[model samples]
Target chain A: MTTSVNPLWRFRGVAGTAWFAMVYLYLPILILIVLSFNANKVATIWSGFSLQWYSVVLDNPNIMRAAKNSLIIASCATVVSTVFATLAALAMSGPTFRGQSVINAMLGLPLLAPEIVTAVASLLFFLAIGMELGLLSVLVAHVVFCIPFAYMPIRARLEGMDPRYKEAASDLYATPWATFWRITLPLLMPGVVSGAMLAFIISLDDFVITFFVAGAGATTLPVYIFGMIRMGITPEVNAISAMMLLVSILFVILSWLVGRVKQ
Target chain B: MLSASVRRTGLLAPTVITLFVFMVLPMGLMAWMSFLEPGTYGGVQWGHYSAKSYIQFLYEWDLDDQLVLNTDYVGIFLRSFLLAGGATLATLLIGFPTALYIALKDEKARNRWILLISIPFWTNLLVRTFAWMLLLRNGGLAEQFLSSIGLVKEELNILYTPTAVAIGLVYSFLPFMILPIYTSLEKMDWKLVEAAFDLGANRWMAFRRVILPLAMPGIVAGCMLVLIPALGSYFIPELLGGGKSLMIGNLIQNQFGASRNWPFGAALSFALLTVVMVTMIAYNLRFKRAPGADK
Candidate 1:
């Protein structure tokens, strides 16, 4: 602990500030989670712990439809983006080629561009092309933004991988396709899985772009929750928010774990 | 068996096509839409070039159809800039210490702290903003707690104000600030700090001269990350500001949704994009990254 030498003088209140900051960060989330289980109709008041709110969420037809839409969109977005990202990562992993920097910048553009801008642009694009703004439009938008998220982890994983294994396989007269299948793919699975998980969560949790692009009958969970929130808070909103938080947190942790696992 | 170059081309095709069609093409269309006349109903009028959308940012047509300077849209842009700037500063003040504390920790504890920080970031932005809505509303937890503690008699009346929106922005983007600063500080060479101390530099001096310069790259990155999103945030200002305070985002949405002015909305997006790009380019030029800090 070299830092212990000046802890008292140098970073006087930093540790305390970190503690306070953590509490500040988690308190609202914790309160929301706890209140989600409250038996009372009012969201803030506590009568007793109850599972009725969760049941109410499950029973609500609008929420269920939104949830179904969310899952379908997230799944399709995750699969498509991850596959495209995996292909891009595989190609870009080999060597620096002409226009590599340009390609890299383009890939990151979706991430760097403001969501509101992208949403507005996408809305205009769909309208200009005479494409109906529905599930398909939202899906197209999700896959676009999600590609960079899916690409980054996979690219990182490939960068960390020992390339000699693939070389050694190819040197043994194994075909390029065989070497990719037998050697590279297994090595990249963790990155691929983690990337897919990240894409899924991002798509599932998206609000801004989805809100703009989604037309009638194409509401996702976050969009539905936003509407619910606008209408006013209820115990049901809390429950659904809690559940959504759980899903995202679980996936993040799972992605972290997968990222840490030995390749 | 495919050649490596052939495989590269094949593998890269999807990404190129997807980005070109969806990202580049849409952005181009938006740029064009920003110049075209807005349609009566909603969309833009094709081939009708008009700079009125851009001009309308500072000027509006009066009864005589003459351009008159209007600060309404500019006011929203200014408010958004100030709010985003304030949020960036707040996050830095809070996040720097948090990041420094984590960076000082040993490996196991460091990982735990990082994960804790990341969870909130990965969580839904709407949910996080909504949580603030619960706390800041009239008679909500914050106000109730203040009253319960005999702090005040009157209502807090913080919700639906710019202050509430500021709080949400700081809270939502704190992690973005922390993570980048942590990334930089984590890779810092602590020996530099020790050398400064050994050379008779006091704690504050060491921090100012040695530690801060090293963390500059991260700080800059964190500021950009926070500023950009904070500038464009719709939900935080919408739900928290209660429509009293309008940021660039809500203003743009209003143009599209209720005002039915697609060209103006697209123009606002371009204006926002220009601000963002200028910030990014200026920062990149000013802050030459510390060598090996990323490693």
Candidate 2:
């Protein structure tokens, strides 16, 4: 109903509840971020702020190595999945074809299936084929897993686009290749970039799939953080986590901006 | 330069092939492995096929080799479902109002609020769950605050309990619930609501007649998103449940890791997959039938 005529009795309560929910979602993360700078080694206690934990995390060779590995895997997965997903999205957004729904389902399956099932199945698949489980295997699995994330944005962008641009290019006697490269590709850049960024973030933040498929020396940051937590909690973990949160937030913002630009 | 058919083939083949090789094949292998016997170690035995794993899900072999009805594993499944259901309900209660609040806000304010929700969604779930552990453990901030406020007299020890697991879960999935319901509410025709009010319907009756049906698709979607993931979640239970409470996810992980029973783990995974797939298909059908549902 109109806000003027019949003010909903629950309006104030709903607004208050919403604010509370937001605080509830963010408070723990805010706590972690603050504690990362705490001078005390203990996680729960609040002492004077210091940059020691951040420095310590930076100096830790194992963490640095794991971070490097994560970068490599995420970059590779992002590029590979973005390419595959773009192509698939392009085809999917084009003329309707027979068995299109089946193809759609296949593309959507990775997202729909539980991560554990995919992780375990990937592990078993690798072992069955006698493939060594390491960075390479993790990369392949990540690319496959990240396809849906990459595809969704690109598909959305394509679907949002007018078909007239492509038709205009072709009507002018431009080759399909030239039309795609000059007309379609440039227009699709925002979607491709956003899709790649999303894929990178998904690959970077992934733990369950990476944990299952990763062998010794193949640990990503999340898996490494899991190991550290399993050993015991410390401020170092907080520092790294805070760092990760910053990066993920940055990527998300970048992707959001890219999507906004397309509009 | 390329024909349409060729262009389509060239574009789509790589993803199809990749998905087939990695996604479909692995699932097929897991299905095949479920019927096979476990090796002495972790891998499956090639030719020793049996229905043992499926039977083991419901019946355990005793010392006397008797087929005993095993309620233990069934209990674990039920517990997982109950916890997931609880988490879904909790998130819905919180998220419905949050989504409605956001939907009612101005465009600029709505975007900022939505961004706030997305930040947590993108944050590493393990880190978030760890923060919960830090808060919920004995003598932690939660306990200190509660006691300081006279809400409780003793230290909080919710860290390793099922309640802690539920809290972690609802926290993890609240955004999934919020975003979808917000989409529905934001796009809804408020004029209909006003018309109902003008036609002599009370606020509750107006909402029941106009708003709830419009929001049902989003509610259903949000419920599925939260529930399915919660059911299969291993980390929350592992971290918050103190490795004591076991869900089907943990059970499946154990079958592969500690138990070294590949067949059994595959069976458990396949079962979970079946349940999820059915839910997804039902969701897709229902979503398709609903007008203005998210594509």
In model 1, the runs with Cα more than 4 Å from the true position are A1-10, A258-263, B1-3, B288-290, B293-295
lDDT of 2 by residue, A114-203 (tens): 899998999999999999989999999999989989999899889888889999998999988899899999999888888898899889
Q: What TM-score, to 2 decimals, does candidate 1 have?
A: 0.97
Indicate the DockQ of the complex predicted as candidate 2.
0.67
Clashing residue pairs in candidate 1 are none
CAPRI docking class of candidate 2: medium
> Model 1, A179-209: lDDT tens per residue?
8799999989988988998899899999999
TM-score of each: 0.97, 0.97
Query: What residue pairs clash in candidate 2, if any at all?
Result: none
